[model samples]
Target: MKADYKNWMPKGMVTGTGCGTIASLVLFLILGVSPIVPEGSAKKVIGIVLLILTVIFCASTIWMYLMYRAFSYNGKRQMSKQIIEGVASYVSIPDGGKGLDVGCGSGALTIACAKKNPGASFTGIDRWGKEYASFSKKLCESNSEAEGVSNTSFMQGDACKLPFEDETFDAVTSNYVYHNIPSSDRQAILLETLRTLKKGGTFVIHDIMSKVKYGDMQAFVQKLKNMGYDDVKLIDTTSGMFMNKWESTWMGLSGSAILLGRK
Candidate 1:
């Protein structure tokens, strides 16, 4: 499970653009050119370029947030805590059973689950290369060690194509990882998850469906039903905190939704 930097293109662009803007601004300030062009050469061009770049930089920041909000849970302060609990409540982790977590970012939910269900072994996969995978891996390992849990493991793998054999896990979970993908490719990921899940096993998906209309919940439910999940549930925690801001603007965004099902 490698962290895919490709998925975070906007975040990276935002950083680069911000740095460029700052550099340009510093250079302009040092030059101290008159507000009006000395001879009306091309000062307006500079002003226009700066303005356009500023707009792009701001928009990129917003796009990064929008991407995060699209799949992340609204409860920024409580997301990691509540998600761990919410997921734990759904599965009765059996002793010695194996579990899988797709895109196990910082390993928060994965480690928490291991702590909650010591009887089960957990393997969390994420490509980590996209953002500090080595650091995150160390933290996840340390978190597990601190809890005295040894049955946990991690690897780097793509969500679109998991590396495990078919029916490898008794339960599988993903959090806010799918919406980043293009809408066209989402079904491929879902079908891949289904292919890996053992019959009668449980699968949980916590992602954002903000792109779809509210009326589509039924269609969404029906789609899962057709996919062979006997039980499907959609939980909206938007009323909690940080959701609206995350969805609407850059600074306060932290959007996420939940969907759980049994395969």
Candidate 2:
């Protein structure tokens, strides 16, 4: 079984960054050559300013390229895939239990978990939003089949309102998804996911846990503990042992974290 998962970072991101850098450079060149600037201190200052802007954008474009390379690379060097597999390793589904993957982009995490826990059947759901138009239920199914995973299925569904009964899944997983949702109640989305988890069910949800996006995640974890969740922990995957500082900075995953617990 080969692992063929599309990266979470879109190719357009790199293209856009590169285009911005090019545009800035072109503007700088035009400013340098054109007769718009008078021959004085002002012209030198303007040239210096344009040069600085070009340098900043050029550096930004390079950083974006590095990020794209990190994700698109195959093999062990692919940090995003490694992180997904790392999160999947934390999941423990009982034999023949049903597992659910929320916002299973490209079915990477879902298929990875299914392969790890062959005894468990996995179902992945996503809205296949236009931002990620390449990712569809059919692509997910095909990716699972390509990875030789048979105990997995894919469906279209919304994350804010999952189409499943409460306590229906023995395990649930999601990665880098919730923050993308255009909603103010991010914690509610997490609770909605937890609602589908059966008693003793395990979950490993990874996403950017910036305090701005998910207010006081430590408090949130404590709230889970208060609710009787066992072994609940909020792991800082971005700067912790899973991902290094440079990787996080280059990939713009500085606030990535995993919330794991058993219901």
Candidate 3:
């Protein structure tokens, strides 16, 4: 069965755009009324300020709308899905081996991997937070059923502290999730994710890895090398190949990168 992959953009993520559009239009209309005010007065200055604000908000609305279209179009085009799949391709999961998808939002990445590796079983975990109200374990299960993926399951869990025991999964993956976590110890979360993998297991973790958010990722990669990790590399996803810089910056996808390695 072909998977009817749902749009990955969460409702809350687009609320700002909607609000900006409405606010800009409303302000523009109100200012068009030309409220009674003396010429060259403070009120005129206020009007100019409001007009400037309207322009800024209007521009924001347009930019955000384009971003929404990009995300939706990419979803339909399977661009991001392919990117995730590309990252997963580096890993070699044994047939019928267990795999885990951390923070599997709406089960898209999990389902993709499950479809790619039919011989493997996959477990997806997410908190189902209110911010992404449309995503729940039920929705994930339904999507898997629609995709005809029988070897996959969904559960509630945290990325920072996975509920599974050490070396429980032969492979692990996540995408665009870690940065959302409001923690100073982002690297620690990555380490925690690796802890769930069996020795020599594979992992592909993708996220916005701007230096501001993830300090010294190269150093972190070196540390992994020191720990005997093999083929550890960081691939930038925001340049020309996957997504251009403009789109990435507008969609908050800038500095996106995938960290691939074997334990």
Per-model TM-score, in order, reads 0.73, 0.86, 0.86
> Candidate 1 on 64-133: residue-level lDDT in tens?
5555444343424433455566765666578988888887776766766777778999898887754442
Per model, how many backbone clashes are there? Answer: 17, 0, 0
lDDT score, residue 233, model 3? 93
Which model, 2 or 3, shows the larger lDDT?
2
lDDT of 2 by residue, 101-128 (tens): 9999789899989999999999999999
By summed lDDT, which 10 consecutive residues of candidate 3 come out lowest?
2-11
* Candidate 2 stretches greater than 4 Å from native: 1-3, 35-57, 73-76
**How well is each residue in 85-170 modelled by candidate 3, as lDDT tens digits?**
66667555779799999988788888878888889999999998886777889888888998788989999998888999999998
**Order of the predicted models by lDDT, top scorer first:** 2, 3, 1
Candidate lDDT (C-alpha), each: 0.64, 0.86, 0.80
- Model 1 residue 262 lDDT score: 78
